[model samples]
Target: MSKRCFLIEASNQEATEGQIMTVVQSSASHPLYGDIVTIVGKNRVNDNPVIISAYSKDSCHLEAERPGIVVMPNSVEEVQKIVRLCSSTKTPIMPAGGRNGICGACLPRVTNAVMLDMINMNGIVNLDEDVMTITVEAGMRWAELIHRLDDKGYKLGFRGPYGGNAATVAGSVSINSMGYAASRFGPAPEGVVSLEVVLPNGEIVRTGSGWNPEAQIFTRYSSFADLTGIFLGDHGTLGVKTKVTFKIYPKAEFSTYIDLGYKNLKDATAAFLEIQKRGLTEELNCLLARESADTYFPGLLDSHPEINATIHCVIMETDKQLAERKVQIIRDIGLDLKGKDLGNFAAQIHWAEKFNEVQPMYNNGFWLNTCHLRPISRIPELMDRMRAIFKKYSLEKNGIKWIADALAVDRAYAAAWVTIFAPTKDKMELAEKAWNEMLDAAMETGGCPYWSGLLWEKRALEKVNDTFIQLYRTIKKSIDP
Candidate 1:
């Protein structure tokens, strides 16, 4: 197998071997330093077999400025100690919680700095079902938490697909992740009731009702002007999260999957918006794209090939006896537009397969998958512009192929996922250009990109409304400065 190279540019310049070793020894001698092993042996962060020639004796660049490191922090005191040292030395620190961040948020900056990995701190501290809160160490796996909660007949609202198994509760909140159930419960940040953050100055700050009166929201009851919100999505730039307490919800009473196929992306999004606008179900998860429908349901795949040009599937659940009635409403919406319903049996079976099937989608194929986020209401416009762009890319001989899907956030909000496949590298570039145009068009229609925090490029970010960016900047300066 050939190894692919990832392009990286460091905001901070790389340090020399002598300087790197000096920094390493400084931390190694610090009181908080538990295990200071050099980045030696074989590198496993990116899983690529390529040899890195420009690396220092212990460290190597994996992606962009992200240098991977493994650290063993034995205690909270140790974490605080390291933070103090990093702050005093002016070294950037990146935290790794379970090493499952797809966007390289945990990857170290290009400078000769320490990467604090919180894998060893996986402990469930307290489970207070009375108030419906679970307090666990920052490194605890979400799946373990879900398993424990399931034993008690409850679970967290957003467990994030299969990635939850390798994900940490603190990491999810830090990244502001909104998994499958994001529409109803909101993102991970909203679920967090309190946070335990180790500041760069070696001080531990505990936020929320843990420190002060519940009614008093004006006071800086926690630490440094109430910086929990700042630290949540800082991408580990500000500080390290040691412990977290968040809300949980009961499992659904009943769940059903309904499949709807459309002749094109426009019709598919129309059906999705219809269900979202009409409140067709309490909990909804939908997958749209004719390709997915064809792959998941081959029987209908051939009979309704044109119907799949835009494929749609919905997952809805309710406790009431009128469950079928609600599903019928969704079915009716689909049927009204000449859409075909593959019924719930296929949807149920797909959900059962879950992430086991999703992970493989990114591997073992000559195709590429990229997505864009937009406000739910503007999905139709986005689709129209995207199809034109796809057509433009398809003029080449490689024969560009693609599929689009949309997930409804609410009546007025939604995110669309577009998958593109092309045979030539130039065609892929053209396809990427289309994706960017789609992203720009989405922003013009009041749609915010779903995960734009760690991409490093600020082009799409600059398109977001200035007010939110100002708020983000203020928070970053306060907590991370």
Candidate 2:
């Protein structure tokens, strides 16, 4: 069986450049006849994968390392045909969005599969200012969406962290992404007003219609069943998302970022819990010593080597003088827990410059890696337990320290993270061990890991009751079987 790849470019709703050269096939082609096709478009690939080749670099996030066959489906019908062919042939069809996933969830694991690249289907269908929602093809990048929305003084919920330099809105939502602004607007799944999916059997379906004012609340299939929810976090294992409609919010007038330090995790978390209760701040992120600080702010390590605990940060947006008061509140609360007030600043220019710098190391040739755990309230007690496990593991000796940060989802919830500095090759193993231990710890506290980290190993999978895999299987069977 010969596999082929094509570089497709769509223009005027038709396959133009590279796609025209490759022969479309239903099954594996002859070695001499097979061609490997890659689809290239603006905002279609990620920057990291681009380093390998100009083809990977130029395309947005949809890089396929051993891409068998790259087919760019320019219209809904084209996508449907591709899905149908794959389903009938039992070929593993991988849908390419922006390929920014750290866990390789978007890429097809099965060999001799077809890659249905969706970067070409990006057409703006509607922008209802009154309704405060926009419908666009699934291939539109968040950066493009942000630019389009900024013209109307609107912004979508937090762009997912997998939201690469050029990740698309559809790809982010397909994986149920959570972004930097999660504290304010929640995850990308929260912003989805509707979805247009091409099922495995080549059926076209719409999740919700913003135009329908009488749309049923949260129902996807029957009035009692939610088909959309089943596929929301399915990680593209269900079907290819062709279009998405999500809500947007007005841009904030003022935004400030304050960085603070605590004596230890206990003191910092105590303050974080209380500040969350007050509900004055817009977004707060607590980066444990290993995660946020090491990835984004490495310079701090050189200056304060002994500061091996945790750093707390917040982005508060408001025109009121409440900025200073909010700082005071955080300080006071931390003080009660015997935490030290590191410093505070209210500089708009500075904060704006640093606003989208979550993984600053990406610009400097380092892979900006991250994973989401469960929400905070359910994980704090578990985090304490994990800390004990870390102590027993003694990571510092291996030059591997677990840096973590968390955001308060509500008064009773917090989502904590752990960042490990190790070789990429060893990361999978370490993450496997850490995740299993973490999952066990979290389960003890009745918390589950985030939706994005659904690709982890058996131990972690067991913690979530194989929900991710089961969801994928159910959707695939329904759509394909």
lDDT (Cα) of model 1: 0.57
lDDT tens per residue, model 2, 1-481: 1121111223226544323222222233412112222323322222221221322322222234444455566777667766766676677777767666555556555555566667777767666555566677877777777766778677776645534456777777776665555666666777777777888888877775422455422223443355567668777777888878777677665544555566555556666667667765556666555344555555544554444444354645445466667666666676776655545431222234332554443432223233555544443465577677666666555445455667655443555555444434454455446545754665566654454432443445555556776976676676667
In model 1, the clashing pairs are 8-64, 289-311, 290-308, 290-311, 375-447, 376-414
The TM-score between candidate 2 and the true structure equals: 0.73
> After superposition, which runs of candidate 1 have C-alpha atoms over 4 Å from their true positions?
1-62, 213-228, 278-288, 295-300, 309-325, 332-339, 364-372, 395-401, 421-446, 453-456, 464-474
Report, for every candidate in turn, its global Cα lDDT versus the true structure: 0.57, 0.56
In model 1, how large is the Cα lDDT of residue 228?
60
Pick the lDDT winner.
1
The sequence of per-residue lDDT tens digits that candidate 1 reaches over residues 413-446 is 5556555555456565665666556556556655
